[model samples]
Target: MNSKLVILGGGAAGVLIAMKLASQNIDVTLIDSKTFYEYTPALCSVLYEETDAKFHQHFSEISFELEPFLRKINVEFILGNAKLIKDDKVFIHQREEGIEYDYLVICTGSSYADPWKTQNGTECIDLNRRINFLNEQREKYKQAQHILCIGGGPVGVEVATEISYRAPGKKITLVDMNKTVLANAPDGIGNNAQRILNARDSITSIMEQSASQKGQEGNTYIYETDKSHTEIKADLVYNCIGVTPNSEFLQANHADWLNEKKQIIVDPGLRVTSNVFAVGDVNSVNEPKMFYTAHMQAIHFVRNMSRIIKNNTNVENLIPYHPSRPNMIVSMGPQYAIGYVSGIKLTGWPLGLNKGSHLASWGKYTIERITMNSCHLKIPVNEVLYLTSRP
Candidate 1:
């Protein structure tokens, strides 16, 4: 009989693992709350202008139907939540018998503060709803003259830049509690991002300030800054503040398996228990929480799983995973970007070009294409120039 392997969360790590294990003798089953896999790295670009040379695309364009994609690779896809994990049996919503697995992998990723990351409490049921919701947000943003973005991380900075590029007249206020944007990153990256944001006419960088929403009065929402005690009013607001792990299902029964941040505690081999494993952002791994890092973890997990299966469920021979510092790139807009690679700081444009002519988008797009292609999906380069375009 084939070894039964069940994976939770159809994000980057889980999907890649299923794809790799499909060709093996293991009977792989992937369970996710959502029906599709979203390329979340490009999600902020959905606010970009609708032009021939645009960075943003419709949600359906970036997302792939998880059920069909997994089916094509001989992996069974289940659309439900993993409600409980007891012994060797995993119980899900609406499924009574539960699934018995020789091995279980938890790759449930993090949830963002924005609705685009999750709608209502879970993912949107299908693609049309996601598209409609994104369209509504775009229309609301277009109508608003003033917008407030709370956070200085990659998502916040990227959203601000996209709005500035799409509509230069809109007043965009970026507030961060830190002294500089990208504070967790290297000093050079933070300084570069600060300079880029400062150069934009429509963007106002308000550092070392925390804003709390007081209330909304008609079209304008009111906020109070913690440091200055000054009032900030905006027509639209994005709470790009925190990332919460989607590991609530583990809380009831397996509380000891999670850390204080609710991330699953894994061993050197990425195992939560003898028969269970966790990877990606959901695990308490000491690595940068980037999409590519999650991919690396997934690949490592595959190798260990292969060993465990070959040794007749013996994990003693499993290889340990060691994480290295990952390279990161952040785009200020379509024209500019900054990156950190191999302990070297990089400008968006390689040849010491002006700040506004950064080709960081080129690298970002290339990474996006590579990620999509790994899952057997190729982005068509018909109207959108994949290589030469700045975005």
Candidate 2:
């Protein structure tokens, strides 16, 4: 009998792995909480009003070629949440049904680490809701002229920049407990971002001693610092602190497989345990948790899994995972962008052109296409690497 392969989560990593393995004639089942995959990178663009408010595109529409591929490979796609893994069988809880699987792959990704983590809450799905909340707060105090964004990370900086661009007349203050924005990034990238933000006419940045106190109401936000208490009158407050790994499903059965930060500890080959693996933001790696990193890891994991199914004992050594050089593109507004490519940083019109290029859009489409094709075709990574590296 063929071994059953089960993948949890339908995000970038999970779908990519399932597509790759199923193509190798392996039995594959993909389980996700939602029926459609949501594109998250577009959230930043939406906040700046660069993208439409209702710009949520379905994965099926985005990757139309994948349906036929999935059918050809007999890959079973289940819409449900994975509750736990026990005795090497995955326990899935659908709306009113339950199922089990043989081998499992965990790629549940991460969740926004908010202050209300201790309580039960609903997760925010799209950028529209976030924007709507901000707008509502702004309107609640029409006379209020200031907005404060807390946290100096990429998300915080992006949100502040978007707000400044969208509502130029409003005073925007960006506060970070740390000394600088993009603290984890290289000095050049952080310095460039700082300079750009400082040059903006409507934004002010400050380094606070601590993140003490909280709560915002209308035009008042009170925070305590190491030196003293500080309060700011703002129409709105936005928090973009960070994310936490989504590993709650593994707590009961695979607790030992998780690290102190609740991230799954995967081996160099991306295997979490015997005949099991983890990928994306849920897996602990030395690299930053970005979409690109997740994409690479998913590809590597699927390739290794395919080799294992072919009775190859040396599958683990087929391809050693290596971290790529940090590359990123940040948009200030509709036609302004800053980008870092292979250590070479550029900004302004050139960056904007690169960002708006059809090639960039097609590259994302190609990733989805390759992911779906992986379900029925074995496209070599060498070719993918070569194509992606082409200028």
Candidate 3:
């Protein structure tokens, strides 16, 4: 029998690897709890003024049936949560048995709480439904005279600006422990965001303050700040805090390969061991925890894995990862955005229209197409609307 290659997580990295290996007639099995892959860029963009029809179309378009796609690619799909990993074996709680493997690749990425970044496929669908319901409640959002947003991260800033765009008259209070918005970003980018945010009477930016939820009462939320015992009351609240790496499965083993925060440590070529590799957000690689980075790692790992399969891969020849600056387009609204690429800061309508528009969705879509094609799976044109592409 052929040596079995078992992959955990059907995320961008895992899916790409499965597609490449399965199409080449290698014995590969993919395990993931998510029914479909998510194009997160679109998710972030939708907080603006995306119509109901547009949201539905994009959500459905970005995610394809995970099981069917993998099966079509000749990769076995296992719809179960992975529980633990021993040397050369994986224990899945649902199966109640350990499965052996000649090689293992883990790509279980990170997640956010609630409406942010959900962990599994079921949670994703539930969140989508909630978003739909949330859309219906936009009236409530607008009716709320004051809105409090906790955390000044990308998502937090995006939500603040999006709310500012949709309901210009609504009061928005964006609070972060950092002294400035996008504190980790280039100084000019953060400064620019502050200028734009400050220019609006409806928006207020609070720095060096952390808030704790004081519970909700009659659709009203109360937050207490650390400094000055400030009490900020608002009608609606969004929590965009941090990325929690999905490495609970590794905790049981006291996995020395993981940091105290549970992020897996990977070698230069993105390997945990000679026969085991770790890619994407789950790994503590130098790269940012973004989908595109995972996709790129997938390509690099598979090329080396292909050589390994053919007994021509030299360990020394394996590609080492070099982290780069994250190029991002952060839209304050549908028509305006702020961005930075290679130390060059750009802000305007054109960047928003191109990189932050539905056109940007097409770029992610193309990557998904290439991934699915690698797996020998033909995503029907109907499955791919103008804005969604998936593996």
Candidate 4:
């Protein structure tokens, strides 16, 4: 029996699944708050425009209209806030009727920072508008004697490196409560990142101290760290810390499926319920919530879904979900980046080999390969199922 599949996110996972399933002529619907998708990997590069003329040129490439993309793949795109999830149905605000589905895939991602950067990477035009302001702020920051970045996470480190490349001679300070940069990653990752970043003469990093408070007074910005009443002053501040899950809607109804962190918990096959499954950051998978990992889970889920849709009797042959290997590509500047793949560091020649570069040639390639979005995917069931289940 064919089924109406509804996916409740427009992130890497949701979009890839929907596009793949839709290409197979499956009835699919994708719901998101925005009409477009923002390619987040390219977001940091948007600020490092090669020429003044091409300031907004890359914005188009980084973010694009989802409606047309979905249309091309034969999936329906609905723009609205998903406010609730009930028995086999999703409730959307500003819509008179609810959408019901035979199978539901929840991929709603997580986000961090003020003004809340949705992990889904939607609200395209709106984000471009904000980036414009950041461009202006970048100009202002270029003139400031000192700048304070209050996180050593990806965003903070990326922006700091970008500034070091774009606007040298200005001081950039990064503060994080962790012992090192990218603390969640492997020890080598954080240590190597710290070594590269601190190598810059103008950059300063403060670790193991939590930012207690931040406020602006007149022309100066103030940040107080938790220990020793440490006060740091700067002309501007960027808070690039913390992530809040976008799983509140599920809590109101499917509370039992959520963990203590409010993240959706799922079985080995990523199933939340009999006909409900989850992928990406919204789910409590024991792995880093990254675009690559999400897309991997999407492929896994879609392949198994194809099997289930084909024959339910071979349930044991359904491939199990596993956490992707711990890998990271942190762009340091336009020409350099810190990347680790399967515990092996990627560096040297071929400018696009690693994560850094305005071209993002390699990142884009990996994304395209991982997505397989528009491909008509079919699974060969009863296969070896040799994939292991750990990072």
Candidate 5:
């Protein structure tokens, strides 16, 4: 009998790995809490106005149903939470018996404050639930007169600027503990973002400040800044601080496999043990936790896994995974963006050409389609609407 391979998480890493392995006539089972796989990089576009219907789409449009895609690729899809992992066996939340596997890969990924980054922890498990949740948030954003965005990172900055483009008159206060926006990025990029935020209509940038939620009354949210000790109120507050890894399931018996930040620790080959491996945001690889990074890791791991299986090679013979240099594109709005790639700073028309008028929504859609195509799944009509490669 062929070895049984089980993969956890349905995000970029796991999904891509499953597709690649299944193509090689490998038997694989994928378990994930989310029923739909979302193209999370385009999540910011969900908050903004749809100036161009061809480029803009609802959050649901970018999130493809997982079962159909996985099944089409000859991979078994299990819709359940992974509760525990014992030696050679994995357990689910409601199941009493553990599922046996010859090889295991952990790609549980991370969770964000926003619902768009839904994975294992998110309450919206199905497509309908996610659609309703996103619609509710969009309604709140449309009616909000004052908005507070806590954090000056990519997510916070993108949310602030996207809302600004949609509702210019709305008063938006962006607070961050850093000296400027995009604090983790290159200094020049952050400086450029600060200038853009300052010039944007009614979007205020309050740097070197941190805010704590006081409470909420009706639709109003109250917050207090730490450094300034000032109280601010807004109709809506977005907590875009950062993401937490979905590695809590490993805490029961495998706590030693995790780091202080609760991320899984793996070797250079992305292996946790002789038969176990970890990938994507859940792993502490000292690299940027972007979807592209996750995708690259999945491709590399799949290649290594193929060698181990077909050639019956030892673990030491597997190729080591090298960390790639950081590359990121931060979209401020539909027409403008700033990026860092190959140790060079980029902005304006070059970014505009890459991201298009819809703020990289097209590029993200293309990525989703490419993944779906690789898995031998049919693209839905809603997704096909934005299929043009003009971006």
Candidate 6:
């Protein structure tokens, strides 16, 4: 009998793993909730007009590109959300049909948490929504004199900087409870960002106890913090706190596999309990949550799976997962960016242009080309069963 391999979540990790395994003729099947794969890293860039939104395309096109290659390797694609896993089989639910898999890989990407009080409140997950929200705030603040941005992380700083660039007439105040912005980044990064934002005529950075309202009549957002309360008259407020893992399904099902943060705990080889593997932001790793790191983890896991399927004695000696070298391409606006690459810190136009073009070109060419070449090999099942089965 042919050994079956199923992958859940068609995000970067899921798709990459499936493509790798299918190339080795592992009878691979991929599943996802959405038909389109959004390039999340570019979403902010798209909003800032550094890249075109049309760059985000349907996954079907990607699937089509892989069809011939995958068929040659005996791999199949399924569109559905996996609901549960029992023993060696996975249960999937789409419209009204049910399906199962022999070996499963979970890669369901994350979703933003709802910000409202209600359980079914609106949650912003995509680039368009974030852009629309920012645009709406821009319009709303056009008549006012001040704007307040909450949170001081990378997202918060980027949004504030962009708004400052777009609306020179309005006063932009960035508020954070921490001592400085970009707290998790290297020492100079946050200070440099602060300097850059401070240089702008319309931007101001405030480190204090949150703001409080003395009176609720005027159009202002008040935040209450620990030390003292400060009030600023503002027409709009943008909140860019942080991200949480997308693990609701796992929590509801195999909670035992998860750690305290709700991230799936994988062994050194990236395999979970049984013949399962987890990757992407959904899995706990020492590295920051970013696209490149997730892709690397997926690639590593795929190689291990290939070894198992090849009856290779060195499967346990597969390459270990490592965090990518510290590199960040943060664009301040259309013309300005800051980051470090290959241990060199960069700022201004060179940073902006290189990052912008790199992002755009990567999306347009590199990913697709890599996917094409990596998804076209075939391997036998007996090798996997022989190598992986418990002695």
Top TM-score prediction, candidate number: 1
For 65-138, candidate 5 gives per-residue lDDT tens digits of 99998898899998878888997888888577888889999999998886557646523288777777777777
Top candidate when judged by lDDT against the true structure: 1
TM-score, per-candidate, Cα-based: 0.90, 0.77, 0.81, 0.84, 0.87, 0.72
- List the candidate 1 regions with Cα displacement exceeding 4 Å: 51-58, 119-124, 349-357, 374-391
Pairs of residues at least 3 apart in sequence or in different chains that clash in candidate 5? none
lDDT of each: 0.78, 0.62, 0.69, 0.71, 0.77, 0.58
lDDT-superior candidate, 4 or 5 = 5
lDDT accuracy of residue 223 in candidate 3: 86
Off by over 4 Å in 4: 50-52, 114-116, 119-145, 313-318, 347-391
Error of 6 at 298 (Å): 1.4
lDDT of 1 by residue, 287-374 (tens): 8787877887887788788876666647865777778455677777765667775565776444533353344567676767767774
lDDT of 5: 0.77
The TM-score of candidate 6 is 0.72
lDDT-better candidate, 1 vs 2: 1
153-245 in candidate 6: lDDT tens per residue? 766677677666655777888888767777666536665666677677787778744544444446665554446555566666666564666
Better of 2 and 6 by TM-score: 2
lDDT value for model 2 = 0.62
Worst 10 residues of 1 by lDDT: 382-391
Question: Candidate 5, which ten residues in sequence have the lowest lDDT sum?
Answer: 382-391
Ranking by lDDT: 1, 5, 4, 3, 2, 6
User: Poorest 10 consecutive residues of model 4 by lDDT?
Assistant: 377-386
Task: Tally clashing residue pairs in candidate 2.
Answer: 2
Candidate 3 regions exceeding 4 Å error are 47-50, 120-145, 314-317, 349-391
